[model samples]
Target: MPAKWVRTFAERRPGVDVELVDCAAAEAAALVRSGTVDAALGRPGVNAEPDLALIRLYDEVPVVVVPKGHVLTAADELTCADLADESCLLPLDDVLGWDARPGTQLSHRPETTADAVELVAAGLGVLVVPMSLARLHHRRDLTFRPLVDGPAAPVGLWWSEPTSELVDEFIGVLRGRKAGSSRGTREPVAKRSAKEKAAARRERLEAAGKVPPRKPKGAGEPGARRRRGGR
Candidate 1:
């Protein structure tokens, strides 16, 4: 979604300069607070902070990555109890943060999700994470299934409050606002002229691959109203 929003922002503001910063999920809010970045797409954690605005983007479903032919794969989905006997490898950057983590806990924690996935492929243990992360470090020897009882990974767009116009424009893009949408504008919509409204409507229709509906027969002609009787 971030990539899509970036493309949308670029297409909308072709003359504006754009840059993307890659950072740890937990550090996204800090980056915004420190003004190191204008905005960031990060996992939820910014609500308690002041002078910050965040828009919840999405909730990623949790999945467990396992080696191919694992017994857990026999079933479509596994519950916490299903993993009771198997080792569960939690990476240092684990996002789920499940309090009552399913499966047996191992002393050795992988440094990152990719390493956890490698261990799973080696039959060392199963690793649970958001579906997107599993897909990120995908391997041929590994497969994943939805962890039905697992927690969701909620992500959002984080930025400082009282944003500048440029940051607001990017925020609008992340919020799926139309290119011409007036964000936080106090002007009344009546400010637009009838011709301008019509043109805008036409543009929207064109973008949607729709043709404007034709007027009823003689509808705009003077005295063209249909008679009540057959006469």
Candidate 2:
């Protein structure tokens, strides 16, 4: 979803170049705090600094990645109980806290989720992770199924003080706010009701000089200029 937003932002802001920085989820907050990046997309539930601003994006559910043709694939989804008999590989970076112990635990946990996924592909064991991570490290030999009872992963946008217009624009886009809406320049005033229609007509007449115009502010003052500006 952020990628899609980036594309839209780029079109609207053609001169601005957006660079994506890849880092461990644990490092995201620090990177933002240190000013290494203008903003960071921090992992869910990671308490941010008091000075930082946070906007919650969405929650991603946990899923299990298993080797192709595994019996668990027969079901559309699975619960922790259903996976109790299998060997579950818990990656070092695993985020979800399971309600039920998944399966016989592997003696050695993989160093990373990607490695855990490789092990799953090799038929060594199953790996559980957030749906986004599973898709990120997707393998042709492996497939995923949503874990119905697993914990959710909430993601958010983080930024520091003295925010820029670019950050405001991105936030607006993320929240589905139309461009220029903040400046009262995009949407026309609703004229559905008779009262509203009459007001709108009066405004049009004023704009067109059909009605008597009010005195311009400071018209008789020395060196007073009209309001001329572009947004």
Candidate 3:
């Protein structure tokens, strides 16, 4: 979605070169702060530097991934206690900051979420992660169910403070603002035609007893009957 947003906004404003950079969350934030990149898109966790600003983009709920025939498949959401006796496949370096639950059994830590996902596919153990990661590493033999009591990860856009024109334009796009307009721009007031003015005058005249008011059309009226039959 981030890539798509960049592409759409760039197309709307030609001559702007929008580059997509893939890096660790912290590194991405650093690059944005250093002006190496115009803006960074990732989870929110950056040191509060003087020249940086962060704006939230979206949030994703954490979930548990299990084998197709696992017992947890029958549940809509599972608590940490639900997996008390089960061996969980935990990643050594999880960005979600997940720690082992009290008294829960854990399998040997894998190097990455991809490794944990592969282990889960092999029926080794269950794995927990954000819904986006589950979808990212979706396998035919595995399925995911939300972890009811789990924490959510917030995704956001970060840029250097005292933004440039290009960065400001990109921020506007991310915030769903239109070009050449202020944030939360309102629709233009519509002009009333001469016929509408005449109609309004006629209604005012009728209201003042200068002319008899016409009866409002009911469902049985000719126009209403025609509309119903057309449908």
Q: Can you give the TM-score per candidate against the true fold?
A: 0.76, 0.75, 0.69
- lDDT at residue 214 of model 1 (Cα atoms): 58
Question: For candidate 1, lDDT tens digit of each residue in 1-231?
Answer: 777777887786677768888888878778888899999877773234455677888899989899889998998997888889989998888877777897788999999887888888889999988898989889988899898887888888878878898788788777777665677232323368899999789888877879855566656877776788857
Report RMSD for candidate 3: 12.9
The sequence of per-residue lDDT tens digits that candidate 3 reaches over residues 58-107 is: 77888888999898899888887888877877687566765555234465
Ranking by TM-score: 1, 2, 3
- Over 110-150, each residue of candidate 2 has an lDDT whose tens digit, in order, gives 98888898899889999888898999998898999999887
Score residue 113 of candidate 3 by CA lDDT.
85
User: Once model 2 is optimally superposed onto the true structure by TM-score, how far is the C-alpha of residue 92 displaced, in angstroms?
Assistant: 1.3
Instruction: Give candidate 2's error at residue 113 in angstroms.
Output: 0.6
Best by TM-score: 1
Which regions in candidate 1 have their CA more than 4 angstroms from the true location? Answer: 45-51, 184-231
Candidate with more favorable, higher TM-score: 2 or 3: 2
